[model samples]
Target: MQLVAPLNSSLRRVPPGWVYLAGLIPLAWVIWLTVSGGIGIDPVKEIEHRLGKIALWFLIGGLAITPLRRIAGLNLIRYRRAVGLIAFFYIVLHMLAWIILDMGLLWEQAVRDLIKRSYLYFGMTGAVLLLPLALTSNNASVRRLGRNWRRLHWLVYPAVGFGVLHYLWQMKVITPEGWLWAGVFAGLMALRFRPFRG
Candidate 1:
């Protein structure tokens, strides 16, 4: 195993709230751009791109919990719920953009696109999967669901796969950046299997 770089003694002792606050940098930047007209009024591509990126970031965040906790020795358990909820937040916004801006709430056309477009179908599946996971994220649900909570959350892995595939299929040329994230995802997922788990 690789040695984890030690955080500052201060950082190791910081409160969980501060850890979450530290994680808000990217979200804050996105919001600033959205509000400052830097992203523009009719910025469909920019908006969609940012939404997809943020969704992927959240997906990475959710996936990182176990690795960070176990491998990095980072005590990331507290961040799991926060990271998961943030993922749900980005996903809801992504869906809202598609429904409100792209499709204009056109149910017939949306249904047609879902049926005809494989990438769109993959994206829709990812979004739909997020709903139940988001709903059951609370402490009450966790207490009630017990071990089954984890079983249900396993859907996030496939959701991430579908999300990346949705993007990769849509891209005219899959860039190094795309491949890098996919590689990271593959490594993370590989860790979940028996051989790599060691």
Candidate 2:
């Protein structure tokens, strides 16, 4: 913990803006790949998958904050909001790519696919749950909502669970990486319980 203390002290000196800026680099990388015809044959699907994967990583990163602080003595409390909002940004882009590019804005086809694909429900449910959290993420809303703000933010746990399931179920065969993420999610959730921590 003593060794980590110095690193944590340096992290505290860094502003959350740095995290936000770093997040954009991936989006730009994804864009460049797609533009250069480097994103594989199905560019739309590639971009969508890349964006959603980025969002999932950020979502998991956001969820890990509390456990990291408690167990590893690392603090990133200030950047959680930025991490969450960036996750939501990629989520929105992922959905838009599916709708506009993949589905060609065809409401009928999109609806049919949504109905036929159960995994889509999990993804959509997670996004819908995140909407309120993103809307109230501002300082003004934090002051306005008071105690309810925390209650509303608790929606993130279910959103993350749905997201994990969405990712796993969409894959025909879950990869080792997917299983690892599931394990990480379970561990983080367990750490939130006093009994498990004990």
Candidate 3:
């Protein structure tokens, strides 16, 4: 408690806007990789993958906020909204990169690919679910929706699960790193439901 006291104290000085600014770092890195020719031969795919991965990381961060407070007494509620919005931004970019760079804006081809690439359905589902949450992630919506806002945000759990599935399905075989992410999500969900009351 004493250790986290100082940590939480420092966090109090940091504004949520700083979190939003820091979220841009991942996008900047991707851009750097692109200019430096370090994004692989398939740059579009690389960009798409990197964006999706970063989005997942932010989503995980958003999901971790409550559990971190509950299990470790570390409060990060102030930045959860920024984290969630950044995640949605990255997801939108990922989809756009795929549509424009990968599919070249060919609607018919994109539709064909969307139908053939079954794993995309998971990502699409997650993105669709996130849409409403993102649109309503404001004070006015919070006031208007009241209790329903919390219920609507609960969609994040399934959306994240589907996002993980989308990620895992992209791999030829689920690597240990991939399994670690899935395990982390599962652990967070467990802690959420059976939080320590001590």
Model 1 weakest lDDT span, ten residues long? 1-10
For 29-54, candidate 1 gives per-residue lDDT tens digits of 77788788888767766777788788
lDDT of 3 by residue, 1-198 (tens): 779989999999999999999999999999999999999999998999999999999999999998788768899999999999999999999999999999999999999998998999999999999999999999999999999999999999999999999999888899999999999998877876634434
Per-model lDDT: 0.79, 0.94, 0.94
* Highest-lDDT candidate: 2
Q: Of the pair 2 and 3, which is ahead by lDDT?
A: 2
Between candidates 1 and 2, name the one with more favorable TM-score: 2
Candidate 1 error regions (>4 Å): 1-28, 40-42
Error of 3 at 192 (Å): 2.3
Global fold similarity of model 2 (TM-score): 0.96
Error in Å for residue 123 of model 3:
0.4
